[model samples]
Target: MPDESATLALGAALWPQLPVTGCVYLSGDLGAGKTTLVRGLLRAAGHDGAVRSPTYTLIEPYELVGRQVFHLDLYRLGDPEELEFIGLRELLGQGLLLVEWPAQGRGVLPAPDWTIDLAADGQGRQATLAIQ
Candidate 1:
């Protein structure tokens, strides 16, 4: 998109079409706006509070708009096996799962239903979505 607002709008537009239960892997380098996109998606789902990256915690769970949503940032993960320690297995299929740095959790994380890859493009970002 052309700007952060555009990126957020793309996410807002996606809210209705997104399945309530599925995995979405967000791929991108640092400062690529992955969390910003997720923030927009959640806002469309009626979340009025802050939407911050769960970089340190690894997972941020949101019980919103009548469903569960979990955002995970695995950049700090030392190993894929660490996901099990965070109860990822139990969270699977329970709600919408948005994962960042999924490459870090390759073996432990389930295959995503959707993948969003973001990259810098001029002053904005280029986001590509893939269904798998």
Candidate 2:
């Protein structure tokens, strides 16, 4: 994958492969196209609205796509406990969770069923997938 299109394509391809209700960990550096991939997946899943990074909000909830979906960006997370305050535990096992900066949530978040790691490769980005 050398560009955003490829990343998006990969995301779209994951539409059918992704679990309807489970955890997915997305990790990568800045500009690694993590959110772009999410946007793509959302779009493929029939989301009509914009898919914004939950950088400030910490979490973005998406519904009506046959299941609940939460996109979490913990880059600015002050404490992982904040997730509990936000009712994350209630959302667990109910739908899909696409988590970025997952390392920040460590002990608070549940074990991810899948992990997607993206890295910049100078000319493009390299993506690695881990299935647990």
- lDDT of predicted model 1: 0.93
Candidate 2 stretches greater than 4 Å from native? none
Q: Per-residue lDDT for 1-132 in model 2, tens only?
A: 888999999999997899999999999998899999999889889898999999999889999457888999999988899989989999989899999999999999999999999999878999999999
After TM-score superposition, what is the CA distance of residue 51 in candidate 1 from its true location, in Å?
A: 0.4
Clashing pairs in 2: none
Would you list the clashing residue pairs of candidate 1?
none
